[model samples]
Target: MKLLFFVPLLVVALVASTFAQQASWRPVDTKILSPWAAEIDPANPHPEYPRPQMTREDWVNLNGLWNYALAPKGAGMPEAYAGEILVPFAIESALSGVGKTVGKDQELWYFREIEIDRSLRREKLLLHFGAVDWEAEVFVNGQSVGTHQGGYDPFYFDISEALQSGKTQSLAIRVWDPTDEGPQPRGKQVNEPRGIWYTPVTGIWQTVWLEAVPEHHIRSLKNTPDFDNKQIRVQADVAGATAGQRLRIRLLADGTPVGEQLVANQEEAVFMLDAPQVWSPENPFLYDLEVALMDGKKVVDQVNGYTALRKISTARDANGIQRMLLNNEFVFQYGPLDQGWWPDGLYTAPTEEALLFDIEKTLDMGFNMIRKHVKVEPARWYYHCDRMGVLVWQDMPSGDMGNRWESRPGVIGKGTEKDRTPESEAIFRKEWKAIMDANYNFPSIVVWVPFNEAWGQFDTEEIVEWTVDYDPSRLVNGASGGNYTLKGQIMDMHNYPDPVMPDPQIWGDQQVIVLGEYGGLGLPVDGHTWQEKDNWGYQSFKNETELQERYSRLIQDLKPLIPKGLSAAIYTQTTDVEVEVNGLMTYDREVIKFDPAFLRNKHQELYTIKIPMK
Candidate 1:
């Protein structure tokens, strides 16, 4: 496996006075608020450490209130900030306190006071942003630090040189996101949101922090688990690496070292575990890892992380239909289409607690998997899934829609693929690869979905081939609910209201057959909706009993297809998003339309349905 990555800029220790300064900032009023909305403290928004897979002891959380201004596109640093917009929350979101839209015509400008503690001044200071939509240019003490593009990937800059005479330095940022106007991967965001489309999220929507690291440190870590062979592959990208430097790795089970190895810098280390414990949804297990950068016997730098052993592939059954296998066995994956959106925060969740709520509720409903629909979540989201045992089908956030797709689900690529401009195609490829590279280590992500519903889908075969070549450990869903092509390991089709499967006889031989989406039974709870007048679902019901009956019927309609070779099924959604009420839960996450116990009971049966074996 290749670690196509960059120097990961991360966060620093949140000292006392920095958080206490943000007490006055507050979220603006919103139509619907999640239960965790009230708990948001502007002084310490998303206080949890941003990166979980790789652990660092020291970092500053730059998430509190920041001075902001919306200036004309191609504008320079603002002379005066309009107001304080909470860091990590998009300007369009209520949590930002400035619920205004910034488009192609304008840039979102942010300025804040950053104080690097006197103790950490000697080391290299790295600035990290969890994600900034579209494009971002940063400055320190009025000097240009760096610029980054692509909306959904983590990026950073080394600001050690930009520091001034004192600990207090001025940080300024200029961001431009065109949303629907440009060909960038904006996912469901639209200039004007309605139905499935959502509000634009301009500027930073994830964590912003700073870290101090030694000259020689791990830039990034890549671990690949081969469950079938009972071995794991590990490699590290090191900063300030020299020819004589070495890498030491210790793999532990229950904190007890099982294997240790030393390899030259940039060399892959393969550690074979004696009877490795397989990680699965039933028993999600993880091995602790300690890695060190060494110059001979002297330890230069080290970090703590973890890895899981799991394999995702396709296998044949008795009838010769390919099944989606986990560790060489069919698990019959089933889950909901999880669009990670919040009414108050839009692109950013109100809090880390709120961020984990959807995942926790997903498991409560007995969902074995979740199709993270056209949105790349924070690293912690995938980290939570890895620990809690849920399979993730990660999507490349869709953009440049209006491309024509095949008219019928049975048809495979009757329409021409979209012809994107050179700039547009490059953005898609760069962001997709970066999204994969940044998230390659999480074992919970079993599949990589490049296109959703044919939105921004170009060079289908070539792109799918690149994805497979990039990471062969996970299965690839060529185009979920999009124009099907004779590529990738899985063929996915979308249907509404009723659970219908593409005839296994037609698609099973070439790819693993699955229903990407079905069963959208909507019932809008009165006060818990984004809007009261125009609530919608594929199949709408008036009452709880009616919704339950319709949903149960849909599940019953899907069970028989599993035995007939439907390898997986994803329901329409996890929660109501904006005006789309076709979710098991309401948009605010205040109400579960149906009892979780009842839904879990019906879903468990789908996993038990056995297919014919040869």
Candidate 2:
């Protein structure tokens, strides 16, 4: 990926003073904080290029300090903002500089002066948001540009027309997030926080930036890998595409050209690769991708990306028991029910390093997979997983989740689906598809989890059927620990403290058996607790030694179950969230109760187990 830097001399001289301007800004007091919190510089918080999967050389970062205020939902823009709130951090977060909640009746407003370098704003200037909670309406220099809904997916507005003829432009955004009050896809967020639910995250919680592209530019890319055919299929979208427009796609392995293709705009391009290295936990080889829009001979737009070859499916074993297969081989997937959260930032991590730390620590502790529990992370998180060889079971964040997990002997989890209004259903459908579309390119994601534990589980058969129809490339976990109709490729069961699998004697031949959740062993370190007193966990231990001993026994109990039919298993979580202390690491991420070497060595055996065949 190429990142071209061209900082003018005048701007270079003022860069040093930017940090000093925010010297007084400090993270509000929290019960605990990650090590990265202390190192945050407001001038360039989360300075890393946000969209690693889609990289452009010339772009301006629109992060840092921004004036913000809370107003009544129906009220117009505030006459005056109370103070500066950090962009990309939720207003309810300690890192946001204004730790306050914006309930369903209120709307959060943000205003910031954006400096658009005339040189960088060539033909088109687009404002990009990694994500904004609930709904957001954008205004450039007080001119309404566009409005976007859905809190977890990325969106942008073409602000080129709204730009004023001035050195700096005014940017304002009005956001309304209902958290649990509204029927949106807000995962694990509640106004009244306790037990499994945490504090509400309102307004912007991810990177906001600016990009420069030609009039006719590549808007998005969806690359699907055909492992059986040894080819990659691409569906590209170009904004302002005109007649005679063509897209050039080139593939490279270690800088050596592998293949190239030129196709007309809006056409799918299939590039061949002979015997490419397959991506897996063992070898996560990524090939460079160069894409460009060609107007005659000259390149109108270009963006750099990467991809890999991988496949996921299920096959029956000799004993007529279905098993999960990755790249045509049976490898047991075991990982944590990773609830991505931070004590300081809540839904947002303090820094990119803080985000990468969770993935790195998960791998260090010997897990190859992570069930991104009921949450969608920033693009960079998936990019890290793709590069680091960590398999992801991406969950659609649960919302409108009051339905009971009702089921009978058979008949597609009958009487369990929620009778949601059409608006709620549409919101779920639109957001789920957007999330899938946004994250489809990453090979790390092997399974798509539509509903979790019957929360917002509606139209089970239709939803699962549609998911399979939409993208047949990956397996679908119909309802992870939810109302399982046995329609998807996986039949997951939720067990606590002890590991268990769906009985192979009965349901083993129909779908891949898995322990969707188990092993919630908790040991909260003193001084690192989210609160002073009560904390929650499925099983609590007094000391580190006791926690480690019980975890070892849990794994000892989990291994033999794989031979019967268990395809995969997910532990409770990666880190302690709020009062739930079941994580391997503490909420502050200051301590790991188990030794990494011992844990990894113990887990390594489960991957080698094989079921007997017919």
Give lDDT per model, in order.
0.86, 0.86
Task: List, residue by residue over 1-614, the lDDT tens digit for candidate 2.
Answer: 11012222322334335434666566676676666676678888899999887899988888899999999998988989999998789998888978998899999999999778887677998899999998999999999999999999999998999998977999999999999999999999999999999999888989999999888999988888899899877767899999898999988898999888898877888878876878999999998889999989999999999988899988888888888889988889999999899998988998888899999989998999999999999999999999999999999999997888853322223346789999999999999999999999999999999988899899988999889889898999998877878778888878778887766787787888888888899877676779977997899989877888898898888888888888999999898899999988888777777788888998998877766554
Q: Model 1, stretches more than 4 Å misplaced?
A: 1-23, 409-413, 612-614
lDDT by residue (434-520, candidate 1, tens digit) is 999999999999999998888878898999989998999999998887877878999888887787777789888889998898888
The backbone clash count of each candidate, in order, is 7, 3
Q: In model 2, what is the error at residue 226, expressed in angstroms?
A: 0.8
Candidate 1: Cα lDDT at 274: 86
State the lDDT at 61 in candidate 2: 87
Worst 10 residues of 2 by lDDT: 1-10
Residue 31 in candidate 1 has what lDDT? 81
Identify the runs in model 2 with alpha carbons over 4 angstroms from their true place. Answer: 1-21, 406-415, 612-614
